[model samples]
Every structure is written in C-alpha cells, then in structure tokens.
Target: MTCTEEAKAELPSDARPEIKAYLENFNSYDTIFIGYPNWWGTMPMCMFTLLDKLDIILYNKT
Candidate 1:
C-alpha cells in the first residue's frame, strides 16, 4: 500500500487529496536539508513522513 492510501485511511475526506499530492511531488528535490529542533526527545512526524516518501533511486543514480 502507498502512503496516499495509508494517509487517506487515517485522515478525513478533505485533507487526504492535498496530503497525497504533497507526497507525490515530494521527490522533486535532488537534495533536501531538514533542520528541526528535537522536542521532547523526538523529531516531528512530518519530517519522518517526508523521508519515508522520498524516492531513493534519485540518489542511487547520481
């Protein structure tokens, strides 16, 4: 199952489409620099989701 499908299952009707579109275009960057302050001994879920959705093939080929 893709992230879009999984995200849709968790989110409500209105937000699913935008979230899916973000994930689909998430791989457009060649290199991403994620800078986030650790809060309560944990990074944000959004960062993890971005990393999880990125395509590894772009790095491997370069």
Candidate 2:
C-alpha cells in the first residue's frame, strides 16, 4: 500500500485503527515488540497510532 505525502507527514495522533483491541499495561514489561511491514521506508500508519498511545518512553532497557 502507498500513502500520500500528507499522510506521511502527519503525526502519530492522526493515525486511525482498523480494529478495536485493548493494549496491556506497558509499564509491566521491559520489552515491547512492534512489528510492521516497511512501507516507503517507514512503518504503517497503524504502528504510529499504537506508538502515539503510549505515554512512556522505554529507555535504558535491560
């Protein structure tokens, strides 16, 4: 799939979900895996949506 220049430039907040699901507590784990197909040298918009929802950044991971 291809995205327009506007979509690519948009922030994660503009991402839309294709399905409804609950995300587990992020603080409960030290490692989180995010998988997505490479589209135009960037991840799909859905991945950005999930990342945007996260309130904390994982730094100094063990």
Candidate 3:
C-alpha cells in the first residue's frame, strides 16, 4: 500500500529490488504471465528484480 508511493519515487533510479518469490525451474515453464502495477508509464523496479532473476531470454514470444 504505502510501498507503491515509495516505489514511484524509486522508479526513476532504476532500483532492482530483491523479490521474495523464487522459482527453481523458471525456464521449464511453457508460459508465464507478468502482471505489475504500472506507474510512470512502466512497471515497478521490483518487477525488474523478478524478471532479472528469471531466465527470460526466450519468454513470451508472440
């Protein structure tokens, strides 16, 4: 709730926060949906943290 406000301010800095969720076989999944709060015309920096942790090179090609 309150973090949204803080995240908005931190977006400009491109901060990659360490997300609490973890996936061992990220690449094994055939499909994955990435949903996030859109602030400042983009996803939160926390999204980048999860994205960066996942093997997203071959993800979502449509």
Candidate 4:
C-alpha cells in the first residue's frame, strides 16, 4: 500500500504502536503466534518494529 521507505519499522523509531489491553497478559501464554502478509519478500515494516521491541522487552526482563 505504500511505495516509500519513510514508513515506520522500515526504520526504527522511539514510537511504538498501541497494544491491546488483554495482551498485557503476554507472559501468561506458553506460545506466541505472529502473522503477517508477505510483501515484496519481506515482512511489513511494522512487524520488524514489533519484533525489535519485543526483543528489547524480553531482554530487559531477563
């Protein structure tokens, strides 16, 4: 839907998208699932951002 790299996640940013309140219980789950449409042989930039942030969150807690 976009033809530019200026979009988020394509580039890292301090801003993070809002998460659902129910998802606050993230650690309660034993398994996590991720789904995204394949775009140009890469995941959407938002996935990159989410995964990057998730990694940081996981790292900080442990």
Candidate 5:
C-alpha cells in the first residue's frame, strides 16, 4: 500500500501500537535517537503518531 493510503487508514485511527520502549526514566537522557526509513520523501505517519504520543518538543531536540 502507498503512504497516502496507509496514512489515511492509520493516521485518523488508533490502530498504531502503544510505545513500549523508553529510557528507563525519560528525563534521565538528554538525547534521543529516532530512526525511520524516509518513505515518500518523509517519515511514515506512524512516526508522527509515535511523536505525538511521546509529546516531544521540537525546540528541545538537539
């Protein structure tokens, strides 16, 4: 399936899995490594979902 189709199907829905990995204590680390394949010139919709769930602040990223 295409990214557009997948986004339409998954973005508006809650089918994304819960995030089970963390830094033991999130604030314990000042850095994070997020890796994803560049699909269709951008990260996947699931990545957005994960980012939203993590509530990361873009300004805080270094």
Candidate 6:
C-alpha cells in the first residue's frame, strides 16, 4: 500500500505509526522495489515525505 500526497502539505503526526505498522509487514515479499523518476537528481518531495514518516528499522530486515 503506497501513500500519495493529495495535498501539498505535511501529513499529521498520527499517520506515522500506522504507516510504520504497515511497512513492518513487508517481509512477506522476497524483494521490494522502490522506483522513482529522477527529478532534479532527487526523488519527489512526496517520496521523501513517505520515507521520513516511516520507521527504517521495520524495513531493514529485508
């Protein structure tokens, strides 16, 4: 489940825990692919927002 920003603003802090919990279940896959088109040599602001909002450790096992 990927989350996209519908509005150009930060999401509420409460949304983080739920997203972290969801990413924690990613082990069910053998490989996870995160693709993004290069924008000014960086990912879109939305991807960074998603990354910063989640717990990296939960996804570290993969």
Better of 2 and 6 by TM-score: 2
**Candidate 2 global TM-score:** 0.53
Candidate 3, residues 1-62: lDDT per residue as tens digits? 78878887788888887777686776678889989878788888888878776636455644
User: TM-score: which is higher, 3 or 5?
Assistant: 3
Better of 1 and 2 by lDDT: 2
Q: Which stretches of candidate 6 lie over 4 Å from their true place?
A: 1-24, 53-62
Model 1: lDDT equals: 0.49
The sequence of per-residue lDDT tens digits that candidate 6 reaches over residues 1-62 is: 13344222334422322233435555466766778866445665656656664446444556
List candidate 5 stretches off by more than 4 Å: 1-24, 56-62
lDDT for model 6 = 0.49
Q: Local error of candidate 4 at 13, Å? A: 12
> lDDT-based ranking, best first?
3, 5, 2, 4, 6, 1
CA lDDT of each prediction against the hidden true structure:
0.49, 0.62, 0.77, 0.61, 0.63, 0.49
Give me the displacement of residue 57 in model 5, in angstroms. 9.2
Q: Model 1, stretches more than 4 Å misplaced?
A: 1-28, 55-62
Weakest ten-residue segment in model 5 by summed lDDT: 17-26
Error of 1 at 43 (Å): 0.9
Between candidates 1 and 2, the one scoring higher on TM-score is 2
| Lowest lDDT block of 10, candidate 1 | 10-19
lDDT of 1 by residue, 3-55 (tens): 54655444442231222545344457666677976633554445555455554
What tens digits encode model 4's per-residue C-alpha lDDT throughout 1-62? 35454544444554344434324655566788999978557676667667776676666686
TM-score of each: 0.39, 0.53, 0.70, 0.57, 0.48, 0.40
